[model samples]
Target: MGTEARRAGRRDFAGLWASYGLSNLGDGLVVIMLPLTALTLTSSPGLVAGVRWAQTMPYVLCTLAIGVLIDRVERSRLIRWAHLARVVALVLFALALSGEVAPLVALYTVAFLLGTAELVADLGTTSVLPMMVERNRLDGANSRLESTRSSLNEFVGPPLGGFLVAVGTVFATLSTAGLYLVAAGALLLLGRRYDPRPAGESAPAAKPRIRDELTEGLRYLRGHRLLRNLALMVCVMAAAWSGWSAVLVLYAVSPGPMGLSGTTYGILLTALALGGVLGSLVAGPVRRLLGTRNLLAVDVITGVIMLATPVFTAQPWPVGAATFLGGVGSGLWNVTVVTLRQQLIPDELLGRVSSASRLIGWGGMPLGAAVAGVLAQTVGPRPVFALGAVACAALLIPFLRVIREDTIRAAVASRDTRGE
Candidate 1:
């Protein structure tokens, strides 16, 4: 029965992954198209930046409630609804672009709704991970999902998106909307029908109140020294990494081998995409061989590469090298952290906990982007890149004590072993 259950889980996970990958590819296109659309409609950098602000600010403010929603409802239904919401938002975006109706406001509203929906989807997916597979396969499942995301969404998504945008905004956006609707349909038709645990196993006698659930997740996270320290480390690293990437256009525009026209910028984006593909492919083995802690240690080399890019006087190679290495580090880091969260959190509270988890980590993304803008304007583009590298290097140190070899080994073992 355990073996049969494990096989079923794998089958279900494969279907889920396919649906996610397709939708994620659409997301990749949307990221590029939306920014380009904004730039076309309004050439102001401030407005462009404001769009980013609208997208990120809500995650910090609204994720706790989203967490509650994920936990309190049937996750599969919530997942389907979130995708449906995205479908509507994307279609609205398509209409606004085609009709030029309420243009900027429509675009901003769409970005806001999509952002909110993404948080819900993210929370649901992370929370449901443990329920989707035998605990023992968590690392492998995470690695596969992360790799696909990096390879398809990061590597392939942008270039495809850029090409579609060049073809025309209306076509690109409408195509993306089509993808979202397809994903929604897939979720409805193909998702798992089995309950997380056996039937008649009774719900917990007293369902924790929403406030209590929220507090419990927070308190548990706080008391778990490993999770607490690792979360903090990730937040700092992500802040710096996000800030640097936010200003990538500025770096490319500066004099260097990396510098190029808009077309060249697309090429560089593709390069980063390819590098992410390579990273995702290798991240699992790297984690297994080095352990998560050692992987983090080795990742510091990439951080140094990123920092040193700014100090060099030469062109493209320096910047390109930094970007590639950073992408690799980020890919590995994502797989490790996401797997850790799924393993650590209990099944019922998974959604809320995962949502609360992101509230701290992803909450700072916009601030990081905003800071990059200010730093670029005030100091210089090179200084901003240098700062990001420094921040990545510093953030890893605190996490070392928590993500030791034993911790990683235990995490992997627990997730991989099927319980009878």
Candidate 2:
């Protein structure tokens, strides 16, 4: 409300954003190096891919419990703890690599620890923003955060991580650990006022048992028609994207249709990140110009084009262009949907609600990938893309009908009316 408060808020938000970027950079390094490290020690494809399996498994297993913890604990501390956990995990892994007995199974445990920490950090970051900044700036703030994530985590970190591994695994792992430690320190520097728990929690009655609170959060998301629909939209979109992504290497690499070299395949993936960067930069202005409804529809349309492109053409460039567009749509969707949920969800319910939504959304990815693998094996990679395109296209009309702009405006108005 006062000038000093504004300055303090800005200072705290800066800390959060800086920590977020550094943490993402650390995560990106681990994501790449973990898999590549597994490959060095194991020749079995399943065991090699099991590294990714270990990392991602926590989203399915730990999200709700982590969500409850975020709502219960001070957010910054939770985030800082998560970062510290990664630091320990990475450092231990690094030390293990120096020994002759760095077992592949042990790597899976480290991956799990890193993933669980990531889940906490990500949910904490999302739920903490509304407390730190003015509501008017949420869209812009989210856009900037998304851009930073795409730029550092997806585009820059993987290649850099690869280079680090080539230098030495111990060096790369230790360096990633350093990034997480610095990220933890960033949050520790923020003032105490920025670290308060959810509002309206002073009253004893407002605090429920953990199980009850988790259930209430789930019910809140399920009961709200708009939020429920939005979550489903995200779930379906994630499935479609994952479906194509599962088989993309088959469609793109040498001896596949596109005939891309290993280096070119990486570059093609970077094109998607490039689009995410541009999309995040433009999201605020585009939301103002086209409005939410049209922008969301664009997300679905891009999904179709992205999946269908490989089916229609054997050229890497065209598929690269399509994936880039898909990334743009993703950037736009993320800023819009996340900002919407933040504004509309009660602050106390924000953590649980967001985690529930993500659970529904990300729950589809593994399934999509699994199904795509089977389908690709049976009918070939091209047919898998076609099936994914069809699934994505099916969402268009329903999304438009249910997600009218006025419904969202009414939801925001209701939240304000309730003084939530």
Q: What TM-score would every model get versus the actual structure? A: 0.88, 0.90
Report the backbone clash tally of model 2: 0
Sliding window of 10 residues with minimal summed lDDT for model 1? 253-262
lDDT of 1: 0.70
Candidate 2, TM-score vs. the true structure? 0.90
- For model 2, where is the 10-residue window of minimal lDDT? 192-201
| Tens digit of per-residue lDDT, candidate 1, span 256-329 | 33556544555556556565666666777887787778777666667667656755743666666666786787
For TM-score, the strongest prediction is 2
Clashes of 1: 11
Model 2 per-residue lDDT tens digits across residues 1-420: 568877777888899999999998887677567766775786443455456556666777887888888778788888999999999887888767788455686698898899889989999999988887788889988998999988887677766777787788889899999999999999977885533355454746666788886677689888898999988887777777767765675666556678865445555677777888888888888988998888889888987999899888988778888988988988888888889989998777788988888778776765666667677666777877888898889998788789998988898899889884
